[model samples]
Target: MTYRILLVDDEAMTKRSLYKILTGANASYRIVGEASDGAEALQIARREQPHLIITDISMPVMDGIELIQRLREDGLDMDIIILSGYGEFEYAQEALRHGVVDYILKPMKQEQVTLLVEKRFDHFMKSRQTAIIKSQLIAPISSAAERIGHELWIANEPGMRKEMRSLSGLLDDTEFMQEERISLLRDAASLISNRLQPQFPHQAWELPYEGQSYGQASESFAAWLDKLLNEIRDKRNWGKRGVIQQAIDYIKTNFADSELNLEKVLAPLGISSTHFYHMLMEETGMSYIAYLTQIRMDHAKELLEHSDLKTYEVGQRCGYPDYPHFTKRFKRQVGLSPSEYRKNMQQA
Candidate 1:
C-alpha cells in the first residue's frame, strides 16, 4: 500500500525540495498535498488523513505546535515530523513533547533523509500490523507473527491473561468464526515455534477444547491462549539463555536492517558486547557473527530463489547494503554469487 504524506511549510521552495527528496527516496511514498500554513495544513490533513505529516514549526496564522494540539483534540493520530531552522530548537523540543516522531534540520541531507524516513516508516508499519492483529486475523499471519512471538516471550501468566482479556470480545463475538480465529492463532504459533528450544515438542500452542467450548463467554479460550503464551515464555527462560535467545530472535526478525549489529542488539538487553559474544558462543555453540551471517545468507538465498528482486536489493534486504561485500559473502557462504544462484535456481 502506498503511504500518503502531507507537507506543510509556508515556503514553496521548502515544500518543493522536500517533495523531491521524499519521492526520490522511495517510490511508495506519495506526497498527497502541500499546504502553506498550519491552518491550511490542518484542513488537508483532515480531508486526507495522511500517514505522515512533515510540517514546519513556524508557519503563520496557526503555528505547528497549535496545529498539533488541534489535531490531538480532534483525535487525529497521525505520525508527525517537525522541520526546524537553527534557532527553532525550542519549538522542536515542544513538538517532541507532543509526540512528534523526529525532527529534520533545514537543508536535508540525502543520507539522513533516507535513513530517518525508512526507520520511521518501518516502525509505522509495525504499529499498523499490531493494530490489525488486535482487531482481526491478518492474512498469511507472518506480518503479525513476530509481534505475537515478542509478546509471548516477555509476558507471564497474569500479564498474558490481562492482554488476552482485551481480545475476549473478539473471541466471543460471532463476527469471526472460531476455526478462522484458531487457524490464525495457530499460524502465528507456528512462526513462534522457531524461537523454542530444540525440544519443546510439537502441538504445544494448540487450544484444548476437551472440557470447554466457546459458549462460556470465551473465557476458556482466552485462558487457554494465556496459558500457552506463559508456557512458551517459561521455555524461553529469562536467564542468560533468554538473553541469547532474544538476541537470536532480534537477528531473525531484523535481518533486513542493514544497521543492526551486536551493540544495537545488546543495548536493550543490558549486556556487554564481549559478554554476549562469549555467552552466545558457549550456549548455542555458534559464534554471534556466524549466526548473523547464516541468518542473512539463508534469507538472501530464499529471496534469490523465490523472488524477482534485484541482486543488490536482495543484498540490501539481507543486511548487506554494500553490493561487493554482499557478493563476496554470498559466494563464500553459498558457493555462488547471488545472480548466479538466482540464475541456477530459476533455470532448475
Candidate 2:
C-alpha cells in the first residue's frame, strides 16, 4: 500500500533533501507536506494525517520531542523518525519516552534513513494486525462465558467440566470489551449469582462458587462477579483514555516541582498549548490551570490537616511560591483559611 509521509525540519535544505530522496526511491511513497518547525509541523500533521513523520529534534518554534508528544497525546498512531545533528543523548532519550518510532542522528545518509523507515513500517504493520485480532476476539468470549454461566444456573447435571471447557475457549479470545463491555459482564455475573447451590461437595460439584458447592447462581453473586470483571476491564482500558490521564499522572508526580505548569506538561507531550488545554478540559471538566490549582489546593489542605508544616511551607510543597496566593486559592476551594481548616479538623 502507498504511504503518505511528512517531512518536518527547520532547515529548507534538509526538508528538500529528504523529500527528494524519499520520493525518488519508490512509487509507493509520497511526500505529503513539509513544515519549518514543531508548530507548523503539527498544523501539517493535523491536515495531512500522514502514515509517517520525519522531524528534527532542534527547531525554532517547536522541537521534535514536543511534536511526537503532541501527536501521541492527540491519539494519532503515526510512526515517527526523529533526527538531530547534535547527537544529544538526552534528546534521544526524551524522544523514545514519547514513543517515537525511530531516532536518527543527522548528517543523514540516504541508505540509513531508508533502512530505518523500512523497519518501522514493518513493525507498524505487525502491531496493527495484533490490534485487529484483539478487537475481534473480545465479544465472542464474553458471549460464550455468559451463555455457559446461564446454562450452569439452570442445569442440575454436573456441568463443571463442560463449563470449564467453555471458559477455556472464552479465555483464548483476545478481544476484550471496553466500558460498555463491563456492563454486559456485570449482567452475566448477576445471572450466575442468583442460582441455588448443591449441598454436598462432590468432586464434580467442587467447583468454587463463593466458597461453596454451586447448584445455581444468584443476583448477589452476579453483582460480585460483575464488580471483579469491571475492575479488570477498567485497568485494561486505561490506555484508551490517552493524554488526559497522562497529564493527570504527570501533575500528581511532579506537582511539587516549582516549574510545573501547562506549558511544561504539554511541551513534553508534543501537543500545542491550545489543543492541550481543550483536551484536558474536555476529559477532566476543568481547564489545565484550574486543575493544577485544585491539585495544589488539595495538597495544601492535606498538609494543614495532617502535618505541622506552616501554610507557606505547604504552599511551596504544592507548587505555589506565593504563600498569600496559595492561602487565597485554598480558602476558595475549602471554604476556610488554612489555619482554620486545620483547627476544625483537629477539633472534630
Candidate 3:
C-alpha cells in the first residue's frame, strides 16, 4: 500500500528538498500535499488525513505543536515528524510529548531524511501487521460464534456443523505458533460458550485447552457445539422450515402461476439466489426451474387424463402462458404433445 505524507514548512526550498528526498528514497512514500504553514497543514490534514505529517516547529501561522495538539483533540492519530533547528531542542521535546514520532534537525542531509522516513515506514508496517493479526484472530471467532447462534436459532444442524468446520478451518489456516493457536481456540471456545450459555445453562462447558494441540481443541469444540445444537433443536420450536424448504413449498403451491419464478418465490424466504439454486439442487436433485417444470408437467398430465379441460386450458393451468411454448415443454418432457398424450390415456 502507498503511504501518504504531507510536508509542512514556511520555506519553499525546504519543502521542495524534503519532497525530492522522499521521492528518491522510497517509491511507496507518496507526497500527497505541501503546506507553507501549520494552519494550512491542518486544513490539508482534515482533507487528506495523510498517514504521516512532517512539519517545521516554528512558522508564521499555527506551528507544529499547536497542529499536533489540535489534531489529537480532533481524535486524528497521524504519525508526525517535527523539523527543528539547532536551538529548537526544547520545541522538539515538546513535539515528542505531543506524540511526534521523531524530530529531524534542520540542514538535513538526503541520507538523514531517507533514514528517518525509512524508520517511520518500518514502524508503520510493524504496527499494521500487529493490528492485522489481532483482527484476524478476534473477528473470525466472533463471526463463528454469531454464525452458531444464527444456525441454532434456525434449527439447522447441517448449517451449524458447517459453521463449526469453518471455525476449525480458520485455526488451521493461521500462521500462529502452537501456543498461540491453542490460546485462540480457547478464546473462541469461551466466546461460543458465552453465546450458548444462556440457552444451555446446565451444559456450561469450559476448555482447559492450554496443553491441547490446535487440532484437538478444535475437534473438542466442534463436538461440544454439535451436542449443544442437538440439545437446542430438541427443546425449542423453530420458525417455519429452513429457508430452502419454505422456498420449495412456495414453488409447489404457486406452480400454476406463470409469473412464479426463483426471484419472486425466494424473495420472501430471504435466501440469496445462488444459495436457493444450490439448495434446490442438493435437496431435490434438480435446478429450481427444472423442478418447477417437472411439477407443472406432472400436474398437466393429471389434468389431461382426468379433467375435460382442453389441452390449451391444461397448459394454461400448468403455468404455460404461451400455447406453443406449453406444447413444446410438454412434448419435451412427456415424449408426446398434450393432445396425443390425452388420446393415448383415453385409449388405455
Candidate 4:
C-alpha cells in the first residue's frame, strides 16, 4: 500500500522539496494534501486522514503543538514529524511529547528525511492498523479473558481450557515481536488473576510467566491455566466489586481518549451495561458518566494548574475535543472556566 502523507508548512519551497523527495522514483509515498499553516492542515487532516503528517512547528493560527493536540483530541491517530529552523529548535522539541514520530531541521536534508520515514515505515503501518482497530488488539484479549473468566466462574474446566488456549491466537497482528507477545500474555495473566484471585485472596495464583521465549510463554500460560482449572474445581464467588474496580481502572487509564465509551469499557468486563453502571455507582457514589467526567475534569485541573499549556490544549487532553463543550463542562463541574481556574490556582 502506498503511504499517504499530508505536508504542512508556510513555505511553498519546503512543500515542493518534500513532495519531490516523497514522490520520487521508486518512492512508495503519496503526498495527499499540502497546507500553508496548521489550521488549514487540521482541516485537511479531518478530510483526508493521511497516514503521516509533516508539519512545521511555527505556523499561523494554530501551530504544530496545538495541531497535534487537536488531532489527539479528535482521536485521529497518525504519525507526526515536525520541521523547524535552528532558532526554533528547542520550541519544536516540545512537540515530541505530543507524539511526533521525529523531527527535521529547516534546511531539508532529502536523504535524512527519506531515511527517517523509511526506517519508521513499519511503525507508521502499525499506527495505521491501530487507528483502524482503535486498540481492539488489546480489547480482543481482554474480552476473551472476561469470557473465560465466566467459564471459570461456573467451574467449567473444559470450557475454560478451550478459551485459555485461544488467548495467544488474538495476538495475530502482523510483525508482533516476541517481547510484545509476552507482554500481551502477561496482560492475559493479569486479567485471569483478577477473576481468580478474588476467590482466594489469601493465596494468589499467577501465570508462571518469566522472560521466556514465545513457545515457553505460551506453555507457561497454559500450565497456569491448568493449575487454575484444577484449583477452582467448584463454582466460587467472584465478587462483582473486582469487575467494577477493573472498569474503574480502565477509565482512569483511558480517560484521555475522546472515543472512550461504554462499549469499549464493556469489552474487557463481560458485564452488562446496567449491571456495570449500577455497580460503579454503588462503589464510587457516582454513575459511569459522572465518574469518567470527574476523572477527565480532575486531570484537566491538574494540567491547567501545573502546566503551561493553553486552555484548549488542556481541555483536549482531558478528552474534550470541542473547546466550547469543555468550557461548559468545566464551568458546570468546577464552577469556573479553565483559564479562571488556572488564575485562581496561581494566586493560591
lDDT of 4 by residue, 1-348 (tens): 788899999889999999988888336788899999888999999999998899998888888888999999999988899998899967777898887888999799988888887866777777566544434455456646765765554455665776666565566543567777777777877787786565444233344545678778777767766666656543233343578768877887899999999999999889899998777654554677887887787678768866999999998899999999999999998777888878765543
Per-model TM values vs. the true structure: 0.42, 0.46, 0.48, 0.50
User: Which tens-of-lDDT digit does each residue in 271-298 have in candidate 2?
Assistant: 7888877766544446777777766765
Which of 3 and 4 is the better model by lDDT?
A: 3
Best-to-worst ranking by lDDT = 3, 4, 1, 2
| Candidate 2 vs candidate 4, lDDT winner | 4
The runs of at least 3 residues in candidate 1 whose Cα sits more than 4 Å from the true structure, single-residue gaps closed, are: 135-348
Indicate which candidate wins on lDDT: 3
Estimate the lDDT of model 1.
Answer: 0.72
Model 3 per-residue lDDT tens digits across residues 1-348? 788999999999999999988998888999999998878999899999899999999998798899899999989898998899999999899899989998889898888788888998998887677557756456446656666654554456776787777667677776666667777766776776676565455354455545777667667767777777667656653343377768766876899999997789977877789877876665544688888997788678768867999888998999998999999999998788899877765543
Identify the superior model by lDDT, candidate 1 or candidate 2: 1
Q: In model 4, which regions exceed 4 Å deviation?
A: 25-27, 125-175, 183-220, 234-348
lDDT of each: 0.72, 0.65, 0.78, 0.77
Error of 4 at 132 (Å): 11
True-vs-predicted CA distance for residue 286, candidate 1, Å: 58
- Which pairs, if any, clash in model 4? none
lDDT of 1 by residue, 112-167 (tens): 76677788788778766655554443322342343334345444344344435434
Q: At residue 2, give the lDDT of candidate 1.
A: 83
**Candidate 3 Cα deviation (angstroms), residue 66:** 0.8
User: How many times do residue backbones clash in model 3?
Assistant: 0
Q: Residue 61 lDDT in model 4?
A: 88
